[model samples]
Target: MQTHPPRSIQLVAIPLVLSTLAGCASPLQPQSSSELQRSMVLAIEREVDQAKAAPERRTLSLQTDLTKLEIRPDHLKIIEDEYSVDGYLAQLGALDTLDSPGLAELLGEDLLGQPTTMVPISLENAIHASTGNNLDVEIARYAPAISEAGVVQAQAAFDWTIFGEAQYQDSNTPQPGQALGGGSAAIVRNASQTTSGSVGVRKDLTSGGSVSITHDLNNNNVESSFFGATPVPNPARTTGVTAQVTQPLLRGFGSDTVLSEVRLARNAERGSVSTLRSQLIATTSDTERAYWNLVLRYKELVIRHKLLQRGIEVRDDIKARRVQDARQAQVADAVARVERRRGDLLTARTNLRIASDQLKSLLNDPNLPVGSEAVILPAHDGIEEELGFSLVEAISDAVTNRPELETALLTIDDATIRETVAKNLRKPRLDLIAQARLVGLADTFGNAYDDTDANRFVDDWILGVSFEQPIGNRAGEAGVRSARLDRMRSVVQYRRAVQGIVLDVKDALNRVFTNHTLIEQSTLSRVAQGEALRSLIVEKELTNAGYSIERLNLELNQQEALAAAELAEASALVAYNTSLVDLYEAMGTTLQRNRIDLVVPDANQLAAGESPMERAGDGQQAGEQDAEGDE
Candidate 1:
């Protein structure tokens, strides 16, 4: 008798076999792919949170006293109302005493050489217009919709599909008469005709399986030559209904493998949204910068104009006293100063025109196209008030809100999705295929179908497993390795993006602080220069008849100095405002800070005639209506 195996060995072998079979059921099961991606993202976010939690990251070492920098509401009012030609002359206590003729002719007309229509626009209006109509923003708007379409296309892979086919055949063949029992060898003919058709519906499952149900029909008419054969139905019909399923147990298994494309497409859609947000932020910041520069140019033009008026006055006084004490050299000096001022005024006008055009380009308003001759007169001036910020909060906001960081994080997610798919691909392909059929045959198609339906049928069943694998699997291994590397690269890129955003926020804050300080210092300088100019003018008047060349030169120098001081103060103020814009952009809060809400229209909304980009404010609505009306 054959000896039985030891009980211990048998037990071990049986469990091993079962475990092997169970392992084959699902060889590659991990956490949900989306959860994996989210976990990785959270890890990165935790790193950022830790960075923000550091004690040193909370406060900034600021040079300017934050409280002392608070500006009065009426601080800019005097400049706005008293920085004109008559205003300056009155400020210098010479409004009624100075006889400055031809000042209007000297100041000249519009810089563009044509009559300019002044269009007053506020910062909010410019931002609103940009959000709706800026060309860069408009171009970026379609990306998310296109990426969403890609997601739809990828999902279509699992949609149910209907299929059908039909075919006809006629054939003739020769057979030996001996095979038909003719005794002598002779050729005989056999003829046949057949018509066949099948129809089916199949669906791909997210679990990496496909199932189908089909109905088959065939009709045959045949004439046969055979030896000792009984007569059979000449015209016969065969019909059947079959169901089949194919599922992958190894490679291509699971939702992660099957839905990889869909996940990638979704990631792309999110990335495109981030890209659009970045473009909007950039456009808004640019528009704010241009607007403030326009304001600065306007103020500079005023300063230049007043300086020219003062210069002309000095030249006229010198000419009027030329015979008394003004030498020819002194007259020449005064005239030269006036001419120089005139040149400066011309330069200032050109700058104003340029700044206006820059704002128009960014706004892209149909009512104020870049090529228009109209000038944009800023209705709002730059804010001079100092603002305080927490470095930790700013960094936290940048990490949370920056779209570039989001896009980079999405890149990592996409790479993770691809890596999951690649690792699945490395598994050997093991498919479980199953099929069942109810078959029937009769002289007619209707009978054949009825027989199958009435249980007078032959039932067929098939169950099988097929496995295939490359000996080396080099391609699959390489794919997995490459995917891992890509994920690593994306992580690095994400870190780089975070660092870049933090740097931007810090730099922006520094500029804001510096510019605020400059504003205060420049204001003091302007005030002191104004007093010095007044003192010089008073001294000259006290010795009006005993005026010397040195005194006249001093007067001219003091006027120029005052003008420079005024320009410095205005430039510093504009810079401070622009720095605030940059700060908001760095923190990804420009739209929120400006009280504008960005609304990205979906494909359905676009089809319904909604604007591609919208802002939730009166300015945007009014701008859109105006644009449509213009069109």
Candidate 2:
């Protein structure tokens, strides 16, 4: 008995020391409600999966106010009164309904008395499915296709064309337009018949030149009885082959002007690809954010459930004490905590439901039925992994890979091409024209063919130049000036895009670091609470005395601490994952991350210019800021 007193004091003091040490410790196990949620989610998921696996007489059953289905993100107290009795009753009823053979399960109870099956959906599966079915991504996917069609349309102007024409004319003139022939001065009737046919191919050159080759055949017969003309008994047939070309000598010459449309179209095509890339990255990032939000809410629900369970235990313990020892106020306090947590539990469940709906919307899973009764469950929980980030590297990567940055660069390329074309157009229009022809004249078709020989062919060739200038040319000057301004505008926009990307990367990195640190601090506080609760539990057990009020109060404190810890833990993980999403998107590497092979028309093949990925606007500024609005 003498040695037992020292041992008792040591045992009593041990928990206090451990509680102090726990303030620096880390957490391992998540709250009990997570397991509860996981089970509930699994059950619902399995049932939904079974429904998809085999067709059934599925029908809509549960109905609620879907318009106000979601609550605001604010955490303001929405319970009617300070101690809402109705709210408490409602939560209790809900809990009872969700229990073994509960209301939620019984409503859709199977005919054969089989359990509801649940399907487990992992995060990766959700992302993949979301990328495929997300409406935003679907809308963006068509942009690239449209851009490709535009490029094709722009290039079609330079294709070759075949043209042919045929005509026959018969005419007779009487005394009004008479001619004399055969030494007769008397007025005679004049008549003529002619047939002509031509076939040709014309092509537009990329150097702003045009070439055409044509072959013409004609047959004609004339009769006259006047001195002005002589009557011919036979018809004359003629055939000729001609080739013509027109080359620009001043304005609209060279690739800059000739291929301006094609170049601009190619830039536009690249911009479209980048735009789609941005959209897809945004979709996946949002999917991740919503997914993690679901994780946090689920964990919060678990914490609330545990708190209520603790409150129930404490309330019962206080009741047992009230009968033996006088502790009425403590009993009331325990009951109050229970009711408070009951309200919280209901809120948590509501939030959980809201999150589940959001995840379903993001994934767009076909198996998940539409309605309040349908549920989509998460297969994975929050996880914390050690990660590192470099600000310089992030900025560098973003400058080179950010979709917006690339788009801005493409815009500059487009502006530059247009500017060059506008400048070139300011010159006077001068074209060099040349043509070569082989002529044949004969009375018969065979004679005409024989005349096609090089020696007999008539070398009818022509060469000339044409020039035109707009008076004053104010329109041309203004167009050139506007194009220069456009190029400058694109430069400013690109610089601004780089700054925005850098800032975005910086913010994401900061969040990641901050959340990781919070994880450590939250885990420590949770450990401390667990130790304090343990100390109290041991103190109450050591004595045959009735329950200690302090021990009961400590349980409440421990419950609060546990809830905070779970929240911090889940929040930290969510923040980390969200940061990575931002980082990858800012770097324009999400396509690579998701293993998507985006197809974009090569700008380099279309023109000589640096790509948007290479620089901002007019030049490359690795680390610079500018003021410009997005187009």
Candidate 3:
């Protein structure tokens, strides 16, 4: 009896064979955390590349679950899931792809009549989905509310005022005269009562930097002294009116002042809104990319499996040749057959595992069910590929639409507002005031009305202007200078953004064109490889030839060509999708109907601004660049 190596031993022999051919197969070997992270990143980039080819019309959900999180300036960690991204990439990291369905099942499903729908899930979607449940869009959107509230507060200083006052008091004490005369009761009751009310309207002078007001009022009072022999009538009543005004004459109105700050704040709020919109654009682009990654993975697995079956046929043919020729020993030929079969088997298994893992990660399903692998639906929707004139049109769209560039422009606007405020603070403090009042006093309420005359009313009025200047004004000047520099920086960044966008669009276009050529070349190579295999097979059958050698060689070559063809197709798909993604990103509207949320000072603050209803046909503004330019 002869014993062959156990399956486990054969599996062990895999690495030995791999090492002998082209170094060790260390796919399962432990990798450093950094290495794993790098691999993941590259994987993510590949997915993004694939997604750009296949755009999905996914609606950006208003509510994102980001329960797992840390909001450091440069990084985010999913405490629950053990996932994290460095702060440097967190905003952009949202564009990575998530896991998808298994390739085996998805392909089978496709064969079984259920075509798969392939969409690119952007990195933004993966980050958002995994951390979305905990993300409070409302919190981020809350900023505008606070800004508006600030406006209200700014105006409150000069709106309107209404005041009222009332007092009643009673006291019991011994009277000096009564105590000295040994009065029957040493306690005396004293009481007093008073009431007053007023209503006024106020206004602020924007040009003059002054305060003006007018008021109307009424007063009633009574004073009684019961400690004396008898209660004495002591009643006093008065009614008065007043008008007051104040103006600034120097530095206060010209430079450092509350009014200036209020104006700057309003501008800041507007810029914030623009910034938010930009963030949403970036997130949407990311989500779209991720969705397509799953599709590509599914496609690769199917192709690999097909190649594996071809390898099986080749192995059988090699074995038959060995049996047919007894004189020509076939040790080397048999070994090669075994190597090819093993290599194909290993490759097929590895691809299946990789595809499964990727799908699980994207779905945010770590504990994926035993059979719940990702399945890629056929993506044959046939998106109209942008060609020739469309390419030019797309370029124009991107320049006018990319959100990051637009956001950068808004940052410049924000800086300009700050500069304006800073410059305003450099003015001297100045103010002016004028007040007039009418007063009347009488022993009785009826007499008080009659005594109410300008002169008799104790007419009092005054007008004055005030001014102040800081000795050095160093702080004010420094602030203005700093703001000016910041404004300059913003402008530079804006220009850079525009340049970067133009370059990115052009580069993506070139890639698309290059892939077009590769697709054609790969197709030709596949044809040539097929002809070579057929020729070698015929040659071996026609004559008593050792042509099995040539047949085997052709088979290997054909295998390589087919693999290249598949890869080229994948690349072409990615390049095509990338062009579309770049076009939409430039246009600033990837998810036609639902727009994603942008990262802003307070994204939660703007929650109310984003409506849940689809705005596809709405007359809302599309891209910031065009809107701002028009404005």
Best lDDT among the predictions, by candidate number: 1
Give TM per candidate: 0.80, 0.68, 0.59
Of 1 and 3, the candidate ranking higher by TM-score: 1
Cα miss at 397, model 3 (Å)?
4.5
Candidate 2: stretches off by over 4 Å: 1-117, 132-135, 170-193, 221-236, 313-340, 368-374, 452-460, 533-561, 591-631
| Model 1 CA lDDT for position 49 | 58
Model 3 misplaced stretches (Cα beyond 4 Å) = 1-191, 196-199, 203-205, 208-233, 252-273, 276-280, 319-376, 381-386, 389-398, 443-455, 537-550, 583-631
| Candidate numbers, best TM-score first, in rank order | 1, 2, 3
TM-score of 3: 0.59
Clashes found in each candidate (C-alpha, N, C closer than 3 A): 0, 15, 86
Residue-pair clash count for candidate 2: 15
**Candidate 1, residue 436: how far the Cα is off, in Å:** 2.5
Note each model's CA RMSD in angstroms.
14.6, 20.9, 20.5
Give per-residue CA lDDT, model 1, range 1-631, as digits (tens). Answer: 0111211100012223223323433212244344434443454454445444552422222243323434343543444335433365455443432212332233345646754555666666677787788889888888888898999999999999999999999978877666335556656677789899999999999999999999999988887665423236658899989999999999999998899898889888888888888998999999989988997887787678888878888788788887787789889989998998988889988788889889888887776777877667665555654465666667666655778876876787778788899999999999999999998889888888788988687578999999999999999999999998998788778767767887898799899888887887887677566666765776788875425667778888888988998889888878988887888898888766766676666777655446554433324442344334334
**Tens-digit lDDT string for candidate 2 (344-447):** 88787778767877877776555553343443445455545444344544444554467886676577667777778888899999999999998777887668
Alpha carbon lDDT of each predicted model = 0.72, 0.61, 0.47
- Please, what are the lDDT tens digits per residue for candidate 3 over residues 1-631? 0111111100012223223323323221122223322432343233234334543322211122322222332222221111111111122221122113442232343323564323222233333442221123323345565766676677676555554444444433344425546646445544445455555565666554544444333443333245444323355666666777766665445433445556556655664565545545454455445444544554455445555555666666665666664224444554565576566545654454455445434333222322443342222211224344233333344544555754564565566666666776687776777788877666665566566664487578787766776899998899999987886676567556655665676676566566555545543454344444445555667866634655565665666565556556555555555555654555555534233444344334335445321121243222212223323
